[model samples]
Structure formats: C-alpha cells, structure tokens
Target: MRFVSKLTMALVGALALFGVGFATVTPADAASGTIHFSIVKGGFFVGAEGGNGVLEFRGRRYPLSIGGISGGLVFGASQTNFSGRVTNIRRASDVAGTYGAAGAGAAVGAGVRVITLRNEKGAILRLQGQQVGLMANLDLSGLVISMRR
Candidate 1:
C-alpha cells in the first residue's frame, strides 16, 4: 500500500509537469487589429464557401477567402454561412491550404458555439470591428482564433 501511494504521487507530479509544459508551448493570442470585409452570402454551413475579400490589420493587407461552414439560429429562424480569413498575402496557396484549414476550423468552432446557444442569431460578421485573439503554431502557419465583438 505504501509503495502504491508513492508511485501514484509520482505519476500525478509527472502529469502536472507535462501539463505545464504543454500550456507553455501553445501559441499565444494575436494582437488587436482591424479586419475589414463584406459578407457575401448566408446559409447552413454557409461560411465554408470562399469569396474574394481583403483584411487590413496593422497596416498590412491580407487577401481573404471564405471557404468554411457557418450555421446558427436567431428569433426562431435557422441559417448557415461559410467564411475564412487571410493569413498570408504573399502565399495564397499556403493560406488556402494550411492557414485556411486552421481558420476554417476556428470559425466553425466559434460558429458552433453560436449555433448551440438557444438565443443567438446566425450571422457572418466581420472580424474588423470585433476584438479577436489568435493562438497559432510556432511557425505562425496554423492558428486558432477566439473573438469577442
């Protein structure tokens, strides 16, 4: 019994240390900036579809594509939309491939939250007027963004 307790304690300590390391390695949030764009359309899984757009932040131009799904409900009505942000202006393929995937995932996740809520409307809003924080990989390629309007 004594030996088992000591082993369990050691295991717990190791797990705590691993958790700390993992938290430290995760990417921090993106700095505040303005992202201007227009909503092209709306429907279920709506934001997944791509539309031509531009994102202006920190005096940089990020050409955006909306190719993700968005869905939600508001005032007894259902809706969906697809959209994605531009992370790399110079590397469109990378943005469309990797960064796009990451952005899509983040957008879908955020959209789901609105969907699950009973009293929220399904709308594809712009990121420019909202406050958003981005948690991305070390290379700044893949990212997870959380936002508040």
Candidate 2:
C-alpha cells in the first residue's frame, strides 16, 4: 500500500507539470476587425452569391472578394449589403477561408438580416445588414473569401 501511494503521487506530479507546460505553449488570443460587403443572390433550385468587400484591420483597409453557391429550396433574387465584425482572427489574411453557411431567409422589398458564420481557421463573422428585392432560400452554402492584390 505504501509503494502504491508513492507511485500514484509521482504520476500526479508528472501530469501537473505536463499540463502547465502545454498551457504555456498555447496560442495567443485572437484579434478582430470590421468588414463590409455586398452580395447578389438568385436562382430557381440552386443559388449563387458573389460580391466584394473591404476589411479594416490595424488601421488599414484590405480589399476582399466573396463568392458562394447554395442549394435546396432556393428561388427569386435579391441583394444584401452586410457590415460587421470578424473575430478570432490573427491577421487580415486569416479572414480568407471557406466558411460553411446554413440558413433560411425570405424577403420582399427590404428586410434586416443577421448571420454568424465560422471558417475552418476558427474565424467568426457576425454580420447584419439590409436585403432588398424579392428572394427566399432554405439551403446549405459554402462561402469563400479571398484577399485581393
């Protein structure tokens, strides 16, 4: 019993040391920035959206392009202009990635829209904006954003 207790204590001490080391090696906290973009979407069964935007980060602006395709119960057409904050990013380039989007919306004339999407790199875009014209959709989409040269 005495030998077992000593071995258990030794194992616990090693685990504590390992945990501390790993914690110290973790990545730094991410940064956030502002973004503005516009998208025009329309279709019958499958829909497509694309637009251009700018990212304001670290007191500089970077131009960006957005495009995506969506399927399932999509119809009509409309344009959406969004402005919001992109978080969990380390740099402006980190905002460039494939973001998975699943949403349902309907609009006639004009309406308010809000959505939160996360990319593979863990960047999250929380956007809200105005959508105009006639449109409706219930689908899954993949939106890709890239920095322009």
Candidate 3:
C-alpha cells in the first residue's frame, strides 16, 4: 500500500510538471475533434448506460469506452446515435475523464437532442444526436470516460 501511494504521487507530479492533465485548459489549448458513440439503456426510475466511441483529433484517432448511471422518472429502453465535437482539450489525456451534464431529449417521432459536458480536466464536449425508442423524465447523468489504447 505504501509503495502504491508513492507511485501514484510520483506519477501525478510528473504529469503536472509537463502540464498534461493537471492544469487549467484555455481556448488556445483547445482542439477540434469528432466522436461517434452509441448507447443503450433501460430501467425503471434508475438506469445504466454503456457504449463505445472513436475520437478523431489532429490527425490522430483515439478509442473511447463509456459507462454511466442515471436516475429519475426513467423507464423503458432507448438507444441513441450521437456525433459531436470535443472542445477545451488541454492535452490528449484531458479527453479521458469523467463528465456530467443534464439534458432533455425524446424521440417520440422525429427529434433533436443536444448536450454539453465538461470534465475535471477542463475538457468539454458539445454533442447532438438522435434518440430512438421510449424513455422519459429529467435526469442528471455522470459519464466516466476513458481512452482505450
């Protein structure tokens, strides 16, 4: 346990020195990226969501895996096809962190959905997508995002 704690601190110190994930991100550090993700979720009053996505930034590609939980007056199941831009990227690793946002969207027939989220590292994502199926109510969701090698 002592060794693990020391290793963690050293790693964080190294990253901070190089200004990776431990600094405030400014517009100057922002890069434009696009991501396509798909999610499936279901439950009654409580729900879970999971999905995978690919991000294209500055001629490089990064794979992202996502998982999250949400609760509200939620019921039934729905799938969403999302495509959006990631912003405020201070470093490549900045995109790999938890993000939370509250949004309202429904696809009763034809619909439009948009949400904005920011993570601890100051990365922001503005996403717009289409939701299919039925699930209703307002909810706050926290998404844990990570980069897949």
Candidate 4:
C-alpha cells in the first residue's frame, strides 16, 4: 500500500511539471509594417469612403485597396491622409481584413486625427495624420482592406 501511494504521487508531480512547462512555452513574435493611405468620405445620413494605399513590409511594398461605409448621424465630406504602423501581422496579406470603428468627430478645413483599429486576424493599426476639407460624423464604420492583385 505504501509503495503504490508513493508511485501515484510521483506520477502526479511529473504530470504537473510537464503541464506547467508546456503552458510556459510562448509563441513566435508577430511582425510589423508601415502603411500610408488616403480616403475621401461624404454623406448625409449614411456615408461611404474608399481609397488606395501601400504597405511597406520586409523590404517590399504591397498595394492595398480600402473601402468602408458608415451608418447613423453622419453628415458632410472630407479627405483624410493617414500614415502609421501596422503590427501583429505575419505577412502582407494579414493586413487585408475588416477593421471596424465607432466614434464621432468633425473636421473643418484642416485637422489632425489619430486612431487605433484592430482586425479579426489580430492585426492592429496605429494611425495618425491630417484631414482636410469639411466633415462631421457620429456613427459606426467598418473598413475593408485587400491586397491589389
């Protein structure tokens, strides 16, 4: 009886140690890239925006297309140019996903804007730049991005 109990305790300890070691293992670090894009938006109650951009990653440049729509209290029109860093992407294609934002802001003539958005694939975009013309909005917006073939 004593020998059986000792063996059982030893087995349990070994399994716990193995489990902890496995749990402590970490995943590979994700890569990041730089991007620049410009979008023009306008509407009354509903708004639409589209533009094109380039992603510089791993010593290469990839062309990207951007489009989105917003619904709610949206009024006016404006053009915004954004330049920023995209992180948590393994490759250029990972940057092609749907990113959504819900907020309210207005721009008259010239204004500066900063925003952070994330996608389903765990890619995050930290963007900030200048907005020109005139625009105002309070709505939910979803932006879709795709690689130019």
Candidate 5:
C-alpha cells in the first residue's frame, strides 16, 4: 500500500509540472491574423483577434483565428470588430455543441438555444460578407469585441 501511494504521488507531481509547462506555452509563432464576431445581447462571448497574440488551447498553440467558436448563446443581428494578435481559434460547431449541452443541462438554459441561433445567423453574415482570411468564431466569454479597420 505504501509503494502504491508513493507511485501515485509521483504521478500526480509529474502531471502538475506538465500542466504548468503547458500553461506557459506561447500561442504566437507566425504573423497573427484577424478575427471578427458579434456577441448577442445575452450570452457568453469568448474569443480573441489581433495581428499577433497568444492562444493556449488543448495544450497547443494553433495560430489564433485558425480554429473557430467554442460554445455559448447568441442572438440578434450584431457585429463586433476587434483588431489584435490572434490569440485563439475555436470552431463554431464545437462551441455550439458544448453550449447546447450545457444549456440543456441547466434548468434555465433555454436561453442558450436562442443565443446559439443568433450566433448562427451572425456567422452566416460574416461568411456572406467574405470576411474569412482574418476572422474566427468565438464563445463570447472573455471576448473583447472591437473594430479595427
């Protein structure tokens, strides 16, 4: 039993060190891109955009604005512009799935559905506008939506 406990402790320590290293990893290596998205009046918005920034996701730095949205609720027709270092990229589909699930789990999560619908609409608008190269979807959590150009 003592041996087992020691082994477990070692493993836990190693994991903790790995986590620290992962957190410090930078998210910018190449010239960052742009990211543009709108946040519905009521929902969580989280994302980043800029000429260069650091995005730590899944223990990797994948050139921000490369992925898409994560998850959350979206609504209405709104536009938010931000110019900065592309920090992270999360796929819209992924975010939708996560948020949808969470919203469903919560008793008052129906609001998520409405927000997500708005997000879809906003995404469509962004796509139709032909703003792809420097853009990405976000969850609107810690997102700072601002206009640049």
Candidate 6:
C-alpha cells in the first residue's frame, strides 16, 4: 500500500508539470465580435469583387473595404451581400489578411451560401451571403480583405 501511494503522488506531480508546459505553449486567442460586409463582383472567365463593409467590435463599428479575385470558369456577373462573425481575433489588424479557399458554387436568379474560412492570422470567419444574377462552377481562391480608411 505504501509503494502504491508513492507511485500515485509521482503521477500527480508529473501531470502538474505537463499542464504548466501545455498552458505556456498554447495561449488562448481572444474572440472579438461580429463583422458585416457587402461586396459587388463582376467579370467573365477572370473576375473581381469589391465593396464596403463594417466591423462591429466592442460596441463600435469600423468600416472595411472588401476586394477579391476569382479564377477558373468564372462566368457571367453577379453581386453578393455577405455577413459573418469573426472568432479568435487577437488584434484589430487580425481581420485584415488573405483568406484562401477553392470553392465551386453556382447561383441562378437568386442563391445563398454559407462558408467558413480561416486566415493566416488564425482568425476564422463564418460567412453567409446572397448571390444575385448568375454564376457557374467558380473555383474562387486567394480572396483578400482589408480595412478601409
């Protein structure tokens, strides 16, 4: 029984040390608030999208400028209005960066899409938008977003 108690105490001490190391290695990311944006896009084969938006963080609204380009079978022209919530936002500048994704989607007359994307700054955006006009099989990627002055 004495030997078993000593072994248990050693195990507890090891776990405490491991917990300290884990906390030091991985710090928690601060979550800020939701962001709202609207973009208008148009092109044939190669296309561009841009518009204005606002970020509602900490009871304040900051305006943003949205811009992007899409390639691969980007047909016709369309306008999209999107709103999303951002998480793991450590700083105000974290929201401004390039978020990459290769998604093929089509919209005729009217359509809706929900997408979740993570940027290089470790911020994740859950976006849902309404698309109008027409588009087909657009493999969009390298979408860059930035703050508007």
Relative to the true structure, candidate 6 reaches a TM of 0.78
User: How many clashes in each candidate?
Assistant: 18, 0, 0, 0, 24, 0
Q: How many times do residue backbones clash in model 3? A: 0
After superposition on all CA atoms, how large is the RMSD of candidate 1?
Answer: 14.8
Q: What's the lDDT of the predicted structure labeled candidate 3?
A: 0.79
**lDDT tens per residue, model 5, 1-149:** 99999998898789887774433323442122333332322233433222322232344433322223334443222233222223223332221211111222221222222222123212211111112222223333332222222
lDDT of 6 by residue, 60-99 (tens): 7778888888888787777888888988886667788898
Clash-forming residue pairs, model 3: none
Q: Return the TM-score for candidate 1, rounded to 2 decimals.
A: 0.29
Give stretches of model 1 more than 4 Å off.
1-30, 42-49, 70-149
Pairs of colliding residues, candidate 2: none
Stretches > 4 Å off in candidate 2? 1-28
lDDT of 6 at 40: 74
lDDT of each: 0.32, 0.91, 0.79, 0.91, 0.31, 0.79
Model 4: lowest-lDDT 10 consecutive positions: 20-29
- Score candidate 5 by lDDT: 0.31
**25-143: candidate 1 lDDT, tens digit per residue:** 22242222333333332333222223445544566566654433433321111123323333322321222232222222233212331211000111122232221222111111121
- The whole-model C-alpha lDDT of candidate 4 against the native structure comes to 0.91
Off by over 4 Å in 5: 1-5, 14-33, 36-84, 88-149
TM-score to true structure, per model: 0.29, 0.82, 0.77, 0.82, 0.20, 0.78
lDDT of 4 by residue, 1-72 (tens): 999999988987897877744333223657899999999989998999999999999999999999999999
> Lowest-scoring 10 consecutive residues by lDDT in candidate 2?
20-29
Residues 41-141, candidate 2: write the lDDT tens digits. Answer: 88998999999999999899999999999999899999999999998887899899999978898999999999999888888999999999899889998
Candidate 5 scores a C-alpha RMSD against the true structure in Å of: 14.6
Weakest ten-residue segment in model 1 by summed lDDT: 113-122
